[model samples]
Target: MNLSICVLPMHEHLIKVAVVGHPSEGKSSVIATLAERDDIRISARSPETRECHSYDIQVGNQTLLELIDTPGFQRPREACAEFKLYEERIGTDNIAATFLAEHGQDPRFDAERKILTPLAEGAGLIYVVDASRPISKDDRHEVEILRLTGRPRLAVINAKADESTHMDAWYALLNSTFNLVRPFNAHRASFAERMDLLRALGQLEKSWQTDIDAIIAAFQVDWQARMDECAEAILDCIEAIVLLRVAKTCNADDRREKERVAQQVADSYREKCAKRERECHQAIRRAFKHQLFDPAPVTELQHGLLDEETWRLLGLNSRQLRRALMMTGAALGLTADVALAGVSLGVGTGTGAAAGYLMGRYAMQPLSMLRAHTRKDSWLSRSMRREIYLGPARNLQIVFVLLDRALGCAHLARNWTHARRDHESIMVTRPTAATKEWSQVDRDAISRYHVAILKGSSEQVYERRTAVRELLVKLLAS
Candidate 1:
């Protein structure tokens, strides 16, 4: 199912948090990454978020939370110094509110007013900071400013993954200022880690805990559904590839005439396989909620999909193919024996071994084209083109290649936060590991899948595909 169909829960009591921090501290980046909304304006330079913008996080097309991205605190120290004097006038609790009321249009306090307005209007404060940098006077002043507002506040330490020299210091200081503190890297975190942070936000205030609980639950359901759909998409591609075939009638034609027809059919079959695989990949991108685009003309996918280099690199060339065939054959034999109630175990084993040996003989040769010559076309017209059939893409190695590349893309797409606006291609660096995760021992789902692709009923294919899909989902999760 697509995300739009998932009936996720929603609560009327909204959880609104104002993302605030000093300029160039990744304040907008944090919000962008958390919301998984790339449309949010983000920049590393000062004053990126000039006007306050609120992003509504929807579940099942219903708004559950609102994240307000506001201008960074440019004058935190001066504002805090000035507001401190007003503590004696109307007490510290009303200082932020009073400061907003009086200086709403003051150009000098323009950024400060935009940031405090949400906190003044009951939105929780999500103070962001570059924890890699040492704590400064401005950081303390901003923390004090939010503390004086008497509102629920949380701190997110946005530090580089490799930069940890000052993380301990930030944790100690931020724990004193906010209800909860978490360390996060906007660029490299996984989907699970992002959800973990959102869950932490739910615990910041008791007033919104119930509603936030509902949001978290709904979000989890939505994510799980996406993973399931993605897995199904990958298997669906396999099913299509397995079922693809091109047939042509062949008369009592000469060898050259038959070879011409074979070449034509083989070429057409290759094109269809490539096209179908691309369509499946696009479907996967949509299922994962990524903006879908045909990235084939882009060499990464084009080359990796069927390149001979990839086959050799993945070790599916000679040795691995023989190994995979033997495992699949043994599993097939076991399945047949089970079907025969152990009465024909030898029959199953011998037939399966023969088939496996025949397949292994052409381990390094192309299997996309085959000859199934028969005298069935005796009544065919001599005028018609002497035809031969090709495909269902007989190459089993193609499956291994596509699976390896697809898994790599899935891994990257699921982990990539929408905030990233780059065009980095998902690369399949380790093809051997990708296709050989299954062992030869026993009739495991993968071994069964290999057997089914060769000769199994549609129902058998569906069942094995479903199991393989679940395993792929588990891989993504890990």
Candidate 2:
């Protein structure tokens, strides 16, 4: 089954903790105990987990905690052979196994060489020991192996219900050998006990707190960066659609031919845009998979095609959409008849922005010619006689008009301006340093967004964009 993974934006306040121990030591059970969730399967036998498993735990609406479970450590002799085999196959020695194989030859070091794999994955060791047996050299060796991982670790003394003696020796050895130590009954571990264990983990290393903080901060920064990129991609798609539309309306010699060409452009543009959207989605999802909240829903928007729901979802109200449509129609005029042809060409070329602009220009030519005639009545007959020359002129006028409108619409949408005020807002603020910065950011973000779209799905790209936008807004506000 395909797992639907939502990537969580990097936050400045999240923690990722891994639970690791030797086989048959209740590593999975500890996770179940800590999470208070029965989703993880537990077993009394060894080697239950063969690969890594990750779980996201929510501490609050905005706070997330991640836990990774790793494969059980193997016996020293078996581990060395596995290491040699793995090294030969992969063309590189496995780091964990190398450490174990080097140390496993000594008879006194067998237990110490066993718990290497779990240690290598940066899992702070939760060395589980059965308190039923007397303190032995083997347990001491295991502690030595965990220390080799060079991570902050905790020792969990699993006291079998019946035997509780020899606690002093265990405590003494732990104090001298391990980083932190605690007692946990896997079968009867309570929530309070789990919280205490986490608290101990928090204090295991003096620098762990800082590392967790850094990871969160990185997440937030990355998320904002991605959103800006997605917004730019959306604009690119719109621009292409507009350019194609203008081209179809102005350039086609015959009506049917014009319609056919436009349709081709539109289809090509749609496929390219769809591909881009997918890439953006996958990148964002991967980045934010560990977050607490689900990301904003992703919706695929087809270039130059507006369904009622899509229009509404663009954050435009019904009246605003109607106005935009009216403006588009007016701008399109007789050119609307050639829209299908233009769409086709746009889709074929996979260049929606250029096609849309071209179609928009084609539609605007007649209006420009009419206006020119009204202004120069003395030249009316001559202009009428020169109607044949109007094709190129009409095309140019359509191009300019469409370019202006498409860009204006993009700006208004990103700036969160309502449709009624969009025209007035255009060119209202003189381009400044802040505007330039925003523009650059938008450009960079869009380029990255396009890369992501090309790699994944529309929904995936949209989600990444949303996360990025949210992060940027938050950062700017701060």
Candidate 3:
């Protein structure tokens, strides 16, 4: 299909949650467990994803929320030993490296990287350590990394059924490190256990309570404004075409000709709407300074890939490097089209440029930043204020972009359903005035049309314009 790209106004709001941890800590398994829904897909194993993988979890209709799984820190036995010797020579009393060195040769370091990167990205850490093993200094070091991330974190001691003594020590050590601690049997963690984990996440901050509310409010307002502008743009296109159609059909009183004109107008609108959606996606990526949409490796190691010099040069724990690469790849694959389309449509062009300047001046209206700020009342509230201020707004942007795409498509197709059952089919068939209509067809069509415009899909805008042209043609014929 020939696609004509165009710029459409964009709404800004998104939430980004990064899940971090050491390698082999079941980070991927956790994501798979959380995203059992059909819409979500976990990428296949790769060197980078050995630590981090990001998933865009669909929470509701027209919403896409991001969850980034990060790698854990995995220090090799030799590295751990060297680190300990270095620390000892430096007169430091830290023994975490010594403990890790003793256990590093064990298969456990592989799991550590799977857990740590996500934690560092401010995903409320879900530290999962083997309860069957004795509480060691390595676990303590992992906990220290969690603490350093400064995000609200919880420890999940994966209870091994036969080991009660080691579990006790694990619990004690976890309590000393994290504010919340829970025991989970990963092999057989129940749904209730998962809910308990979510509950722990919910209780971490009161910011969760009011933050989403404010974000939703801001998004709704901004989205509505964008929709109105889209409607206006569509209407303009329709009026232009309708006038031309009326002139062509000299029988200005023929109802059939008028209907034909409206159909044509709607078709034009749909095309424009599709283009706009592409533009919005591009704009969002540019705003974040993200070039590739799919995750790509940030660094490469040659010859001695795991050498100490290479590790130090990368500046990331094995898990962090893994997650970063996975995230880069995922970002590249998932949103490459949007990025390319946005650039082509001038979505990233600065206000100094004519096209961009015109858009900012005519399309987007600035709102007060005061309303987006977080309120502080108590000590806990003060501590959570930063998260409250940024998290919801970020999440809102993510939701906005996804919804914009879905709604924009719906408007072009002139139909909206709660499910994606026939979305692909609907997108292929161009609607015309000859199609059977239900009650309030015009209003429904117009509402969906407006939604498409707001979301910035050139295809939908074109479809609506085409329908309007067909309607005008029928009017003129009558």
How far out, in Å, is residue 235 in model 2? Answer: 54
- Stretches of candidate 2 above 4 Å error? 1-16, 45-47, 60-64, 77-118, 210-478
Single out the weakest 10-residue window by summed lDDT for candidate 1. 336-345
Q: Tell me the lDDT of model 3 at 159.
A: 51
Q: Candidates' TM-scores?
A: 0.83, 0.34, 0.32
Worst 10 residues of 2 by lDDT: 384-393
Candidate that would win on TM-score: 1
Given candidate 1, what's the lDDT at residue 164?
A: 80
**What local lDDT score does residue 468 receive in model 3, on the 0 to 100 scale?**
48
lDDT of 2 by residue, 1-478 (tens): 0112234344544455556555656676666555444446565545666666766654224435566665554453444454455556653433565555566575543443434444554445566766666875545545554554456677888775567678888788777767888998765653345546666766776545553333334434544554455444434443343333112222334555445554554454445534544443333333323122111122332322222333222322233223332333333342432332322333444233333344444333233221211112235444322111111122222222222223333332323211011233333432111212234344334333333343336775676556545534443333
| Residue 329, model 3, lDDT | 25
Better of 1 and 2 by TM-score: 1
lDDT of 3 by residue, 135-207 (tens): 5666666666555445666666655356687867777777877778877554344334544555565456554
Q: Which regions of candidate 1 deviate over 4 angstroms?
A: 1-11, 45-47, 60-62, 247-264, 292-304, 315-320, 327-352, 364-385, 425-432, 441-444, 450-454
Clashing pairs in 1: none
- Tell me model 1's lDDT, rounded to 2 decimals: 0.68
What lDDT score is found at residue 460 in candidate 3?
A: 70
Q: What's the C-alpha lDDT at position 475 in model 3? A: 27
Worst 10 residues of 3 by lDDT: 294-303
lDDT of each: 0.68, 0.44, 0.39
